[model samples]
Target: MALSHASLSLISMIFLAGSIVMLFFVILSGVTSTSPLSQTYFLRADTHGISGARAISQWTYFRICGDGNTDCSASYADPPVGYAWDGNPNNAPAELAGGHGGDTTSSSYFFMWRFGWVFYLIGLFFEVLTFGSGFLALCSRLGSAVSGLLSLISLVFLTVGVSLMTATFVKMRNAFVADGRDASVGTYAFGFSWGAWTALLISTILFCIGRHSNKADVPSSGRRWGRRSRSTRSHRSYEGRRVKEEYP
Candidate 1:
């Protein structure tokens, strides 16, 4: 079925809204341990007997929580991997326990998490901009082009963020398992993170398609007008010839 400009705009808006909502949930994961919402976390593991570490630790974007997010520490941006162990090198996993004196986490782990967190925020910012520009898509191809550009930017940021987040946590989980501790990934967090990226991708493609479709319509309409004008001119010439014949 062919989609009109209005239909494409509306669908794109819907997908963009969904992506925004999913990203919000991912960001807010460990704010509280309230029912299903608390299930949203990147990684969870048993860290029993570790100094300054919770018996059950759940890591989110802002804060690290305990016992399925029931108890959370103060929230902050770009939370360090060492936050899980109170920055105690002795309490953290071997891979994360930095060699330098007084260092709680390895340089790789620290920077990976920090960059991932920053990227998430950047992606969200661009997504908001795209949403704002998307409103004009119904009326103008320029608007669709702008929205598509913004969405593409958002997608790049999100793709990097999600990849880093996944790698950091997957390695963390493996480290915990190797240390004879139980660890697992949070299903809700995994789903939402990737889901948001998928939605934004679809929205971006739709915007681009809408812009091209509108552009195609213009030339077709012009061609139709050209044909109509030629036909009208021919009819007039034929009528003049008939009049001249009758008079002569």
Candidate 2:
């Protein structure tokens, strides 16, 4: 079935909008990773015991990754409470302290900001893919190219992208479970993973839609109506043409 040019454009715009929003949230998660409270909230929400080197009155706090003596990394801890971070495997990383179960590692915060970039980059790529495929199919008139590439991009990215995000969500959940913060929080966090799932589904739809040409007319009730149109017009003109006379 054919999609109107307007419909194709609308679908692309919707996909772009959704991708941008997802990218934005992913970036926000990264920026806020700088704060201990935000870090703790997510960690706890995922099920990890949140603690820090010393209790600070604030909701968030930052500390160096290893001994202040010498380490290239920094860490954020939350609940603004008692715990310590030493790179030492023996001092018991916050992830292991009290045999705590929640987040996989106090270590993850060290890399959490990267997730934002990952999301933004992937989202941007998918948006570009949608727009490019659409342009090839609609504007460039390379409809076949859209069909061929759209399937590949959609299948690979939609599946792999969702998988990566799901893995991260699961790791977070395990962390929370280990720490014993509150299972209810992880329930809400489920939306994070579900959102990715939704994005994948929408992408699949758009990708499939792009693979076909807009010029292909859909079978509609109007087909019979259109069939009658030519006949009726010709019948009315039939006698008129037959009556034509030559001028002297």
Best by lDDT: 1
In model 2, which runs have C-alpha deviations exceeding 4 angstroms? Answer: 30-42, 45-84, 89-124, 132-155, 168-172, 179-193, 214-248
Model 1 gets an lDDT of 0.86
Best by TM-score: 1
Model 2, span 117-201: residue lDDT tens: 2543454465556555555544533453453355346446544544544454455445535655332222222344346446645
lDDT of 1 by residue, 155-184 (tens): 999999999999999998999999888999
TM-score per candidate, chains pooled: 0.88, 0.48
Q: By TM-score, how accurate is candidate 1?
A: 0.88
